[model samples]
Target: MSLVVRPSPAIWVDGEPATALPIPDRGLDFGDGLFETLLVRQGQPVLLDYHLQRLQHGIEALAFPDCLPRARDHLASACKQLIGTPWAALRLTVTRGAGPRGYAPPERVVPRTIITSAPLQQDRDELSAPITLGWAEVAWSIQPRLAGIKHLNRLEQVLAANEARALGVDEVVMLDARGLVCSVSAANLFLVEDGRLLTPSLEYVGIAGTRRRLVIEQLAPALNIEVVQRDVHAAQLEQAAELFCCNAIRGLQPVSRLGEQHWQDHPVCSALHAGYREAVAC
Candidate 1:
């Protein structure tokens, strides 16, 4: 049997529930869109400003500058609609709206925005548990133009996620085409080495995750650790004292193994995780 995919349940669109975009939409045709996955706390988005900034930055990168108006108010209001859930995962998506055939967009553009919210599952608490990981045979593409934006083109991650499942690892550390460590399938990769926090630079590959940004600037200082951005390789993974992955929803998760490597809970990883939680909870 083959697997079937379904669109996410729509929560709001152009001020209507269950609304869907037209077929010729650019986002559907060419991945001409950007999105943010947010964690809702007590019906409010955490790190909301950062999420919007990233989304706006992504929009501008895609040549739709100022295509999105102030989205914070609309996003917060959408979250309020899910107040009964208390904790939810909200996905906000923006497409270059609709247009006629051909790569060239219409002289005028009208952007389409979609927001969906669902109750965050309890199993996500397992993120605190140190999980297994492995390297993916699939490598991320080096697209400098598209680098660092949470754009709609995610075929790489989808492949990486499948590789992780087939390899029976909780996550996969993806490499760039140059074999430099970029990120895990679903989140940003971080390793603690010699008392400093290190993660891959998103200069040429990978998305600049909102939580990763927070960790580099805010979480590291709170944990009293120096953070560095540079190319990391599998060889460097062996030198890491502790390992973790982070995202807006899971916040941060410790890694115990990547292939043959094994790690125990370290003070630095624990401290950083606590700091991450405090930052998100606040």
Candidate 2:
């Protein structure tokens, strides 16, 4: 794939406006980085702390130098430019800066932080609409060490998203190497069964989404809904009483159809979505 660089006014590198990253940058060359995509509401990044916490975990796991403070400051500066905008998408990326021509790390590392912002395209009505999901042909490889963090190595998600597009579904349910359901291409999956809410365990694969955590720890609990983390099989989708997917940007989206099975009028999902909107409202 040829790399196409487009100039954007919303890009910030090391707390300054810039259009391009240096050649040989580790993020570009080897995907040696971590990123967080946050929903910007009223010019502020929602769930900022959760995103940062995940990034910190990724940094520690990757043995990268501490750069969260710098990344945070850059993100704040970038967000300030979106003050009048009602909604936007913010991405904060941290990479082990340009290095010599090998996998060996430089004795001293200076991580690069890039912050970018774009207007959020999905409207409230669009986000509240029910969507369809298909099974992904691409299976997630089990990598426990990198399981829960949002690292830049997303080729698996990229492929799954392409498959979803081809299949004419809003998203695709990805399975781990063992054929256990993990998550959707870009969100966390939740299954409602027997009046209990269940989500796939991220111990072996998938990103531990901030929205997923919020739903499990706050929204569901507030409504007295039981939330369980376990190995959910693909077959369970057919039997689920209700199904939903969530991410920081889109909040909670109920699934209307998955293959031949169909769902309607998800009361639990509706309540949870209302709770999420209330929690994140500016």
Best by lDDT: 2
After superposing candidate 2 on the true structure, give the runs of residues whose Cα lies further than 4 Å from its correct spot: 1-9, 124-127
lDDT tens digits, residues 1-282, model 1? 767554354488755676666677899999888999998877768888888888878978888847556456667678877766657889988888888988887889888877887776543433477889988989999999989999999998999999999999999999999999999988999988888888999989999998899888887887578999998987888679988898888878888898788998766767776667666666
lDDT of 1 at 86: 54
TM-score of each: 0.93, 0.95
Give the TM-score comparing model 1 with the true structure, all chains together: 0.93
lDDT of 2 by residue, 19-61 (tens): 8897778898889999999988868888788899999999999
Which regions in candidate 1 have their CA more than 4 angstroms from the true location? 1-10, 123-127
The global Cα lDDT (0 to 1) of model 2 is: 0.90
Q: Which candidate has the top score in TM-score?
A: 2
Candidate 1 — worst ten consecutive residues by lDDT sum?
Answer: 118-127
